[model samples]
Target: MANDGLSAGAAARRLGVAVTTLRTWHQRYGLGPSRHEPGHHRRYTVEDMVRLQVMQRLTAQGVSPAEAAAWARRAPSDASLSGGSPDASGGSPELTAADLAGFPSAAPHPGASGRSGVSSDVAGGSADPVDSVPAARVGDGEGGAPADLAGGAPADLAGATPAGLVGSAPAGGGQTIPLGPRANPAARGLARAAMRLDGPSMRYIIEAAVTGRGVILAWIHVIMPVLIGIGERYEATARFIEVEHLLSRTVTEVLAAVPRPPRDREPRTLLAAADEEQHTLPLEALAAALAEQGVPTRLLGARVPSQALLDAVNRTGPVVVVLWSQLPGSGSIDQLERIQAVPHPPLILAAAGPGWPVEGLPPTVTTLGDLASAVRLIARATSD
Candidate 1:
């Protein structure tokens, strides 16, 4: 923060990112520091810091790194330092709709859900219902397209819906995943990128949400909505399976990228999907969330056989084990029973996801209703 500038470490700390990330930005995107001395390493000048902040904010909001760098490089030298702009609050200017004119606005499809409420199952508690807003009519002048996201929709995806549906809506008319009326801008941006099959953009938006809002908030507010919206789209149309798969893959990658506790720290918590359940995004979210709290966990992803799970618990001696099942067919009570009957049973045995039956759970088995509760319960159990 000196008049001269800040070192790479100091700047990374200020931006809440790793020094290597700064290095990457500098090396790949040309957003490096300019201040140099005859006998010292370069430091990030105030202007450079402003540029970096812009880059960080945009990327966090789901803008691709390349595009974000372009905008950051164009930021005014004193945009954040000098008190001269119209809204001179001593920070970067808020990017307006006009500024993001290049990105396509996600138009609402006729068949998309109009409600803007979060489901209780996904929200991790009682559903918070907002008054339903009718689905915006696309192609009509009243609602030409949804509001523009920070990272504009990619060009090819502007009017293209997924291929091979029975009766596909016209291009540019119903190409979007219906996120309801009040979806988060980041969620909308992510959906746009997913529909475009733009992996880099999807990763950028997800990583940004996870970085800026923590695993829990990011999952609840941003990632879950898109996932649900896409699921609904698939249910209604029985199409866009490709979009779902790519988005799921991108989410998995981003969540896996979250840093874990030190190698020396032993993992005491174990997470696994039920015997035939393949839906592990929730579990992945849980793992990342636990990692954020400095907890290490063993995640046996997707369709973990009961014996394999029991063997894992017996070998690792985990204090907490959470089993997830996404559908009734996959929620086998025998899996939970067998784990509980292990010679040295885990201290906390939890059944998560909607698959588990409501009535006949074992006395010792705890139910994890949502991501927030799972993180808190498992983190506490492990810490104990």
Candidate 2:
């Protein structure tokens, strides 16, 4: 077929994606056939096919469809789509993560994984990961929150975005997490993908962020705002728990994929969700963020019982132990009291997540306010 183009069915077959999916991509993302003739239907040019392939592969790798579309929209002509030689064409040959989202990209780092690494190219290890994420500022306004600020925990999400869409329904359909008018394009892309439960699109956006901006920036600027916005939606309508769960699972997968601290360096930080507490995404973020700085943490993961937590602490003998709680009921004071009462308590006993009471009974316990502050504090506390 000449550059005149391939039919939708043919394009679908070639890309190995369904025609309906192709339609969705075209309608939702503007990744449609660009070639037209006098009497026939529009056909997908080679470039269009190439763009669709990019969208498909990225989504399959756990990137959200909407975000994949964003990248696809600006994709280079003849972009590598599996087994063909791409004929380089008109646009910039290279597309930076910043270019896709209108944000700054991290310098390439030898230490970070390709797209999966918690990469940071800053020298001297002095650059703050949280500080490096670009602002989510929609536009300059007195009422808008500055974009450079980072969110710490679920409780710290008030700083995530400038506007909240508490009761608003989305433009196309059912519901949406409220986004500011000037929301980061990447964030907007992520929100659209999550709303549609487009898991691959979400992963692509996040993994791309992790690859281009490091774990902390990815979470702070891309994943965190969507989370808080969705949580607000759930609060208002009591719906979309599935959306929340899918997004969280995707985040957990990506964060877990971040390279761990070297095996030679023993893990000195112990992380666990409080008893009966199921929320641990924040803790996962902390673990990955710490790992970015070459710090190892033994994450006990969600809903660890008090006894099991204590047993792990005793076994690991970590220098710092961080307990996470996402709600008040699960953020019990007794857990802290008992941990403090352990025969060998970690040097730093930290309370994380928003579930814990600010005024607590345990004197030795310290509250972790947000992701960056937690990472910064724990890395320092357990410095070898």
Candidate 3:
């Protein structure tokens, strides 16, 4: 056997079992270490360790060690176990598609047919927790329960089948099956538009919009890039208007659907504006972003008179002020400094857009280019 082979004692230590147990099984059950070399010590591969662990979990649940060992010995050789496909370890493999193919019908539950006395069907029915619980309820923070792997509720029954199974079972009363975040054509279109805008700008906007779903990778690699490409076409030529319009509409709808974070119950407030700033898109985007982060923002909308902003801040006692001038004109920075001087002025002043010149922006104010920075700055201001 190879010298790398673990001694029986070493194998037992690795498996957290007594060495005597390992020797007893090896001697009696014919599971003795393999003698890779004619007269040398026997060796065991890492796969053997995993099989042992699986066997251990089973035995702890009242299975006889002999039966569990038998299952482990047969599992590696069983083609039904998916050809012992490589797993994350790169040593012990993942089950092959062929292996999983026989599941759901044949396996019912793992080791269901074994003599361990455990039932194959859950709750004596066809339902699995993946289907029985509401997708939201699964991870809905009530008591820290984890949601199912699929995220939302079960797949659509219309699409459910042996070859193409979809929706799971309905949770509770069985009258309503909540629709999970499955792909919606309209939502995808909006994502496409945001994608076209591209860059960090579109990304920040979409991240704020889709808060609950763990679709970050999908957004970055697929959706955002495509959206950015479309946006580039629009800026390069007017041919993308129709697509842009569709994207904008879908984004608005989807954003509207996302549950707004509960407003801070404390009297603290915030006032934001796009002063004489025709670029209201970024401002609206920021306002929505703030709301998602739990700030109560009163958006003065686009093109507010300078005097009106000063008065509103005074009346609202807002803790912070955010201004966006997409096309900052001459002396706009001076005008912002004047706003910062208002009585008992808000703790933070954030200015974005093109109107304000970079030079001479006051020390009291934060100049931001996109939503992400604005969120961080606002959060810091609030905490302080």
Best by TM-score: 2
User: Candidate 1 vs. truth: CA RMSD?
Assistant: 12.3
Each prediction's TM-score versus the true structure: 0.61, 0.68, 0.42
Q: Which ten residues in a row have the lowest lDDT in candidate 3?
A: 114-123
Q: What is the lDDT of residue 159 in candidate 2?
A: 21
Model 1 spans > 4 angstroms off:
1-174
Against the unseen true structure, what C-alpha lDDT does each candidate score?
0.61, 0.59, 0.40
Q: In model 1, state the lDDT of residue 305.
A: 90
Q: Model 3: residues >4 Å from true position, as ranges?
A: 1-228, 261-271
lDDT, candidate 2, at 321: 88
Residue-level lDDT tens digits of model 3 in 271-304: 4444555333334445555566765567666567
Better of 2 and 3 by TM-score: 2
Ranking by TM-score: 2, 1, 3
Estimate the Cα RMSD of every predicted model relative to the unseen true structure.
12.3, 10.1, 22.5
